[model samples]
Structures are given as structure tokens and as C-alpha cells.
Target: MKKGFIFDLDGVITDTAKYHYLAWKDLASSIGIEIDLVFNEQLKGISRMDSLERILVHGGKEQAFTLAEKEALAHQKNTHYVELLQALTPADLLPGVKAFLDEARKNAIPCAIASASKNAPFILDKLEVTDYFNVIVDPATLKKGKPDPEIFLKAAELLGISAKEAIGFEDAQAGLDGIKAANMFAVGVFSGEELHGADLLVERLDELDVLDLIRR
Candidate 1:
């Protein structure tokens, strides 16, 4: 039985991906690089610095900036992203999110956020669901990002559960891979065909019964 839940924040909880894309797009443009929604998809479930590094490499400017310069660029992108996030409201919570959360809460299931986003807390606050989570694993504290299992394992640990007893929800393949690597049941929340190894796949969370999932 799954004793706890771990979720990816951006695409799983809310649609911060747009804001991220916009911020990155602007930053890339300023640096004489161009990125589209397709390219932005690769940035999902990764750290800001890693995403920036990818963007730099995509633009053929990977070695053009020093570590300090890269940090500054990442900061600039975050500043813009944060500004965009101010527009988020509880209404922005994705389809079936609140209902699923409520179901988990009713059953006393511990829930933790295991997102790549450093702005997870801020986004949670904006969505007015800060109290719903038992833990929010800090990406800054993790040495490795998604596809490494570190974040998911840390979240399960913080929730006082074994990784095998936790269920992880993600919209990105990297996050799904991480959950599986952590020995947790992987729940994929995307319509894409790429999430091949998920234990369960849904276009959205509401399609799955919370109690049923936990009992599996």
C-alpha cells in the first residue's frame, strides 16, 4: 500500500510552465538565442541553473559565461518568472487538483512536493494550498535533480516513509524516471506517449481515485 504521496509542482500542480517558458524565452532572446515551446519542454523538471546551462548550450554560448555570470543570468530569469507568478490564484489550480488533495487529506495521507522548482513554496502560497503539503523538498538541498531519484527519496524520507511506500506524481519523464529509480510507484500526468514506464498514466489527477490508488 502506498502510505504517502510526492508530487511535482509546476505541471502537476499548476501551469507555471508558461511563466517559465516566457522568462526563459525573454532571457534567451536577450542573449541572442531563440527558444520555442518545444525547446522549453526539455527544461521541465530540472533546476534553474541546469535549464540555463541547457539554454546556453542550445544557443552555442555554453562556454561564453563564467559561473558567476551564469548565476546572474539564472537570477534574471527567476526575477521575471516570479513577477509572472504574482498573477497566480487559487483558481489557477489545475483540473482535479483540489479534489484529489482533499481526498488525500481526508484519508490522512501525507503529501510532499518533490519539484525541481526553487519557487515551489511561492507557487504553493500563490495557489493558496500551502497547508496541504506535509513537506516541500528543497531543490537547492539536492545534489542531483530529476532522473536521479534524490529528490523523490528525500521527500519520502521527510514524510517518514520508505521510498517503496510512496507514490510519485509527475508530468515529466525525468520525474517519472526518478520515482521509479527511488522504488516508488510512478504516476504520470501527461498526454504524451513518452511516459512509457509509469505504473499509472493519466491526463489529469482526478481520473484516478485517491483511495483506489493508495490501496493498489
Candidate 2:
């Protein structure tokens, strides 16, 4: 059977989640909404806009802004995120992650990025690993987010592989849920017991035998 690998972006690829947290924190503070660690946990694996909306609504401030106003706020948060990500490069690739990607390519095992991030492609370009993934399933191509399976399932479709033939590399419970919903095995990286459903979990990105798993 043909095999492929899929990955999430934020926590999986670069450490952009810190920047995301910062941006959201700033936005929440400006709106007099506290984005505590508890709120941050709820925002995991969810879209930026969705997270902001949730914060606003849950804080009883959603009605304060018009739709266009809310969009502007989301855009401003994205600008902050982009600014923080300006220093990202291939050198920032996680320890041994690039080596694993290279091995997968050398073994003819296809790969894709199944990210909820709309900026997945841009981030990959900045990291110079855009060529590593044969396909990238981003928010622009899907209506549903993590835990829905649409994104992962679409990635498999684009990679021409079945869900069972793909390994979904995730860093959060939502991503793991999406992978399992698509009927594929999940590889959790550094997440807590929330990722208990993962078929295989690793403490770091460098701990996997990419070629062995794909070929076997």
C-alpha cells in the first residue's frame, strides 16, 4: 500500500504558538478580556478568528463590535503574529525534523501538511521547507476545523492516499481527534494525556523512525 505523512503547523512545525499566544493575549488585553492560560488551553488547535470570537462571546463582548470591526481585530492580531514570525528560517526547524523529512522523501514516501493555519504555506516558505510537502491542506480549502476530520481527510485526498496509509503528526488533542476521525493513526508530539488516543506518541519530533514506519 502507498503511504504518506501529514503534519500540523503551529506547535508541530515552528514554535509559532508562543507568538500566537502573545498576539491573542495582547488582543484580549486591549479589549479588556483576559486571555489566561485556561482560555489559551481552550483555543488550542482552533483557528485564530474562531478563538478570538470565542473570547469575545464568552466575555460578553461579541456584540460590542460589528462584523467588519471584528474582522479588523482579527487582521490586526495576524499582523502581530507575522511580525513575531519574521525571524523564522530553515535553521529554526525542530531538532532532527528536517532529517526525518529528507528521509521520507528519499524513501519515496509522500508528505502533506494538514494544518488549521491559513498561513501554513507562508510559514513553510519562510522556513524553506515548502518543497518537502507534496500537498498542504490549509484553512482556505476546508470548511471545518480540527476535530472534524475534514482537513486531514482532504490532505489524504490530495496526496492520493487512504487515511489508513497516512501517519498524522499532531501536537494537540484536537489535531489527534481529527486524525482519528479520519481513521488514521496519530503521532502526538509533546502533548499531555489529552493525546492519549494517539497510536504512537513521542516526546520530541526527533524521536521517530520515519522510513521504517512508512515502509512497514
lDDT of 2 by residue, 43-146 (tens): 87888778888989878898899889999999989899889888888887767688888888888888898887788888999999999999987687688888
Per-residue error (Å), model 2, residue 38? 3.7
- The ten-residue window of minimal lDDT in model 2 covers 190-199
User: Candidates' TM-scores?
Assistant: 0.98, 0.93
The pairs that clash in candidate 2 are: none
- What TM-score would candidate 1 get against the native? 0.98
Clashes of 1: 0
TM-score, candidate 2, is: 0.93
lDDT of each: 0.92, 0.83
The list of candidate 2 runs beyond 4 A from truth reads 191-193
